[model samples]
Target: MKRPTTGRSRHSGGPNVGRPGFAWALPATIFFALFAIVPLIGVAVMSFTSWSGLGSPEFNGLDNWNKLLGDKVMMQSLWLSALLTLLGVVIQTPLSILLGVWAAGQQKNRAVLSAIYFIPLLLSSAAVSVLWRALLDPNFGIPGQLAGIFGGDGNLLGSQAGAIAVLTFVGAWQFTPLHTLLYQGAARSVPPVLYQAAEIDGAGTMRKFFSITLPQLRNTIVTSGILMVVGGLTTFDTVLILTKGGPGTDTTITPYYMYRKAFQSFDFGVGSAIALVLVVIATAISLIMVRATGYDKMNSAQEGI
Candidate 1:
């Protein structure tokens, strides 16, 4: 006997029903191929060649890589980049978390406080650089005047150590608000029951924060730390505008050095190699952070629960 006809036939659609998934993904695939994949491949290929912008690229295998290994300036740039990343993460993380927690717990003036905190983020990097440059001017800047009052020179941008410190501080100042916002969202998502339970147990604010708030924000902290590290490593505009990697390459982080090599010196090959190295370093660091924090496992366990 023939089966009764169904409203829909599974065999009729078969796997064809899922064929449209590729169609939906086509635009994104094309975009990634054209922009990300293509450029990455081009950069990788160019890293092995001596390519002046105007001339045809000449294959010079390992020459650029060899130079990169022994170049003192390049080494300095890499070390400086690492230092900036460390300083930025160290300074921004705790400050942001504290500010975020405080702002989230506020019963009044929350909006106003948030707005004020985000003002630095709203300003363009160029603008911030210019503003700080003026404020740090040795001749007449506020910082310089304060230094003079202390019977010291006000030329913060004139010394290598001072330039590095100022740049690090500027980076932290510009980005801490963004971290604060991230932490605020994470803080607010914590279950109210957790805090209440802590209170009932006679836990004070600091105790509850350590026991509940921080533990809940582990993923966010890791995520933000990675982002801040990457940002610090790739920092350019503010450094470019304010210091121009001045005081004898003291502030010339890897990205700015890469820029100088590619554009100023017209050495695209060396620059491409540096760029690839940076990409590898950043990716490895991010992976290490995720692994150390057990971020993936935590996410999976959370989902399972």
Candidate 2:
């Protein structure tokens, strides 16, 4: 016989009542708080002040926030960031998903396909930038020389639209491989039985892909899309080396613009404010992606789909 209790322990209803994993997570929690949370709090504080990173910080209240509203360059950078995020999400997301699906289908040659997809990711961003810079060179570059054939202007990197185009393409190229691998792994984990069933049902390749593969890969797609969004938001290395935010700020996304403000002009206050804005924008974007892509619910629906 067991003794019945009138009242239960406070944590009696929860699975975590005696979990060791929670205890083990304490160190990481403390580390994240110390590094991420503390710095973020400091930045939030600094955003409200007018500190030049040299002298005393003056309390400016909401002055910086108001300034952000009317600052043309800052606004332009935000727009540029938005545009890059759009292009990246549009171009990279579907392409990576398709590549992952194709790689999954190439089971016999999966290793070769994966290696080809991953090679670009292994290269340093600086090297990729240098390669593209040479390729876009007006005098000797292939793209520029090709443009000359169409009677088009040969200096792609030297024009605002061209700079944005090149930067966006480079951004897509660098990030697509990572997302491809992620989706490929996810696709590989999907049961082969599903594909067999689809084939048995007289489903064509395109139908199987659209009806079976795509639905199954939704979670992976959303996860990789979020990653692409983050990459778009903070892209710097390639843009720095390729366009250098040139052609009159057309390609100057938020991060690069913030870098210029903080490092080049030595405007720490404005730079800090821009940094805070970027953080907010990034956070908002992540939230939006989660909502738009149904990412949070995709895992629960993955097996059924």
Candidate 3:
């Protein structure tokens, strides 16, 4: 009974429907290629060449990697970086969870407490590093003066072990607030009915936290742990400004070591290789964490919620 059959289908009423989908995605695709793909390819290529920032890179097969394997300082730097990451995850996770729970329960002063906790996140890493440096100074700083009262030195940054510990402390101090915020959000999102039912069943605070709160927040804890581990591994600015990888190569993590290799030693090839190695290490650790935490299953369950 129709007068004529047109080329247009009922599912797609307009001629431009399918074409526009691709057109809409083209810009984002191009931008990603330009910024992410291009730079990554450049780094990979540069890793195989010997280049000082000024001239054409000479192709030099696996020389940089071979040298990296034998370089004791580089090995030490990688080990130190891993140790720092481990220390950060172990120390920060529980503290962040506790702070998050405390803040989440504060009905009257929640906003004020959150704002105070967020202050460290606002400051630049360089500024935080400098502030701590002066605070920990042995000769004329407050810590030094306090130590003098007890016949001890406050120059914690002057010894290798002490410097690494201070660096770890500074890292935890600055980043814990972020994880706390994340945990607090996760805690607040738990259904109020669950807590009400727990209270009716005579569950105490500790019991409810362990039975209800922690299970709900498991994914968040894993996410925060992964982020802290990655940040610990790649951190450079704070360590650079505070310790400069000093106290006899004690605090030199991979990122700082990479910077020293590229700029100080004028060896971009080796630096790029180190950068790639760090990327591999981070990726492997993240994959392991995701698998161990059952992150995919948790994500699906959260989505259903």
For all candidates in order, the CA lDDT equals 0.87, 0.80, 0.86
lDDT score for residue 107 of model 3: 80
Clashing residue pairs, backbone N/CA/C < 3 A, model 3: none
The positional error of residue 33 in candidate 2, measured at the CA in angstroms, is: 3.2
Poorest lDDT segment (10 consecutive residues) of candidate 1: 1-10
Give the alpha carbon lDDT tens digit for every residue of 165-250 in model 1. Answer: 88988887899999999999999999999988888999998899899999999989988988898888889999899999998788
Q: Model 2 — TM-score against the truth?
A: 0.81
The residue ranges of model 2 lying beyond 4 angstroms of the native Cα positions read 1-31, 145-153, 287-305
Estimated TM-score per prediction? 0.87, 0.81, 0.86
Task: Give lDDT for model 1.
Answer: 0.87
Across 61-107, the per-residue lDDT of candidate 3 in tens digits comes to 99999999999999999899989889889888999999998888758
